[model samples]
Every structure is written in structure tokens, then in C-alpha cells.
Target: MKLTASAKLVYNFTGPTEVIGLIQASHSGDQTILSEELILSPDAALVEDEDVRGDRRFRTCLSTETSIVYTATVDNGMRSLLPRSGRQHLWNELPPEALAYLLPSRFCPSDSFQRFAQREFGSAGDGVSRVMSILEWIAAEVDYVAGVSTPESSAAHTFTVRAGVCRDFTHLGITFCRALSIPARAVSAYSLDVQPPDFHAVMEVYLENAWWLVDPTRLAPIEGIIRIAHGRDAADTAFLTTDKACTVVSQTVQVSRVDTAS
Candidate 1:
């Protein structure tokens, strides 16, 4: 499928602010970019870099009393097959590099949820089955309410509240999967045709030596996801971060399918 995605971010800064933005479609085997551009108003010099985790970042400093607007648009081709249920890797079978996901992170405190996960999903037959069960459980239990969760919310908190947005759902899913010793991580992406269009969050689990995309929100087709970044949690994958005080003036995201190959 061919997709065009765009995001517009407007901010008002009080002083010189150093900012890092991660709002571009990732260049990877799963997706190929046809065209893309990012425009910054009151344009400042930007230093672009790709981090070790494959997140593309543009760093720039804004002048005092600045009103900044950043817009990005991209046309890309995405290839993602909805995965079938199958055998998954054992802890001992996973590569050493994949072990990091098992450890607790800020938003996904896997260690804290281990007992609950085992009690809740221990009867599941295999890793893939267990992960599916986790996703189903979250969907059945949580309310997808916006504003119910704050930026500081974590898997434990979301579990207690039984409600949150896409990121919270993704966090809880990752927490449960990791609690069961399945290596799962957070993924940020542009979701084609999601209602109330916004940047979306999902989770990827390593199974059979490969990562499979899963969405607890079930908002868009996994095939429609245009990945932007991957990390342990939202903190590492946030689209915008600034060192100085700034208030968001407006934000908008759009995504649409331009074409599809049958």
C-alpha cells in the first residue's frame, strides 16, 4: 500500500529552547519512502541524526519568544502481513540482544507485573498464544478514554485505572508480554485512517526470531502502520522533546492511503 502521512506541531517558547523531534517515517525493510519533507517556520539550523535504536531525530534550538511550527509529509510504501498464530521463541532461544526487552522500563515495569501476568495468563499454551491472550485481556478490561491518563502513567497505573489512550494500552500490553518473558517493545507509527487522527502507538513481540506487530487499540490495520520509532516505552519514542519550557499551541496529524498494490 502507498500512504501519505503528515504532522503539524505548533509551539510557543518562552526562551531559547533546545528541541529534538522524531516525526518521520522510518526507512526500513518493511517500508520504503517515495517522497518526504519537513518544514520548520522561523527556520533554525537542524542537526539530523539516527540513534542506536533506529529513531531519526532532528535537533535544533529556537530563539527567545519564538513561535515554531514544524510540518512533515511523507509518501511511502508499506508491506506488513497479518501474522498467523505459530510457535514462539523460548527465553533461552532468544538472541542475547533481545534480552533487554525483558528488563523493566519506566512505563512498562515488567518486574512488578510478573506475578499478576503469571496468574492471569500462565495457562496459555505458547509464547504467541500468551501474547494474544494479553492483548485480548487488555481490550476486555480497559476503557479507551482520552485524558484519563497523564504522561507519567505506567502499566501499573493503567492496570489500576482500567482506562487510557493508545500509548497506555501499548504500555500495558508490553508489560504483560514482558512479564511472561516474551520480548516485546513499544512502537510509534502513523496509522492510516485512524479516527481522531493522531500519532499511534503499538507493540512488537519477538517470536520465531522475528518481530510481529500487535495493536491493543485495534484502531487500524497492522498493515497500515508506518513505523517511526521503537523503544522501551513512550519516553524514548516521544515525537517531541524540549529542554526549555514550551506550550503547545496546536497539533494535527493526517494519514491517508494514496494507493495499494493487489
Candidate 2:
């Protein structure tokens, strides 16, 4: 199966920003279940337009702007895809073993987070039932409201307070997975179904033999869904950043999932 997606974020900064830098992971990652024969572009020139990833790493410098746009297209294999229950676990990075090392930035999976996960999820190791329980509780706890929370919110904060947007939910969920020793990371990108000029977040849990997308914000698992990029946290995949302060006044985005030939 082939999936193509587009994402754009419009920023209305209160003040001018200098040297806008963007770190995007919108490229579709290659997985045992899904082979990324062609990812549009990992990085590209900054414009009020579309972007994609090529085979290699892409980088660019953006002029100070309030809004940023990102995008991706992925060729996914339909068969050989693993079920949620069969996702692989990292025994080597189990909490006991990983606690000593902090997980590298969102780019490299961390050992510290794994150790934290191991300690919490050891009881329910390799059990989809257990993982589902954790996800459900989180969805129920977190409030899906944009502009209400910032990236600073921690996993423990969202879990204990239960009030945040998709980013916070994803952060909390991914952190919990790490705390339990399951390889997990936060996904920041765009969702077609939702209004664009906006951002979305999800959790990618390394389970069974592959990574699966879980949207705690929507309280559902996203399989065969389009992905823009991924990283340790929202900071890693921020679409827009400014040197000075700014306030967004208005923004708009449109996204859709299109099917292509195999």
C-alpha cells in the first residue's frame, strides 16, 4: 500500500523572529513491516509550500517566519505487517539495564527511558492487554485541547494531572512506555483528517517485532496511517521556531490520505 500526506503550519508571531531553524523527522522510516521504498524528503528548502524526504538526510535554513510547512509520502508493504500484540521488545534496554544511560535525543532510542519503562511495565511484559490498559488510562486522563499546554509538560505531569493536548498525551504515553522498558518515542507531525495549520502527536511503541502508532489523543491505534516525522519529543520535530517572541493570530491547514497503486 502507498500513502501520501501533506502538512502545513502557519505561525502568527507577535514579534519578528531571526534565524528560524527547523528539525523535521517527517520522513517515513523503514521498518520490517513497512518498507519505505521512497520517502519524499527528510529536509528541504523553507517555503509556504510542500516538502518531502529523499534517501539521505535533508537540511535547510529558514528565514525568520511565523509559519512553517512539512510533508511526506510513503510506500508501505501491506503484507508481512506484524500485529500490535507481536511488536518487538528491547530486552537489552530493559529498565534494569538501561537506567544507567539516558536515551539519546529523540533521534537515538534511549536506554534510560527503557529502564524506566521496564520497572513500571515489567509486570505486564509482552502483553498487549497490559499495554492497552496503560494507553486507555492515559487517554481517559489527558484532555485533548490545543493551546492549553506547552511542550514543557512531562509524562508524569500529564499522567497525574490528565490535562493536555495530543503532544502532551504522546509525550506521557511514550515516557510511560520507556518507564516500562518498551522502546517508544514521540511522533510530531500532521494528520490529514484534522484541520491543518495545526500539529498532531502520537506514540510509536516498539512491540512484537515492529513499531506501531498509537494516538492517545484519539484513544486509538493508527496502523497503515500516514506519518510525517518522528523523534524523542516535540522539540525535536518542531515545524517552526523564532529567534524573537511572537504570537500566532490565525492559521489554516488541510490534510488528506490518498491511496496509490501498489
Whole-structure CA lDDT of model 2: 0.52
Candidate 2 lDDT, 87-163, residue by residue in tens: 43458644442332225444233344565556555566354645675677775656766666655766656655678
Span of ten consecutive residues with least summed lDDT in model 1: 65-74
Best by lDDT: 1
RMSD of 1: 2.2
lDDT of each model, Cα atoms only? 0.83, 0.52
Candidate 1 TM-score, true structure as reference: 0.93
Best by TM-score: 1
TM-score list, all predictions:
0.93, 0.65
Tens-digit per-residue lDDT, 1-262, candidate 1: 7777888887887778899888987766677777778788777898999766566888899854444333334443445543556566777888887898888999999999899999999788777778878988998999999999999999899999999999999999999988888888999999976889999999898887788888889898887888899989999899989997788788888888774566
| Residue 248 lDDT, candidate 2, scale 0-100 | 59
Clashes of each: 0, 34
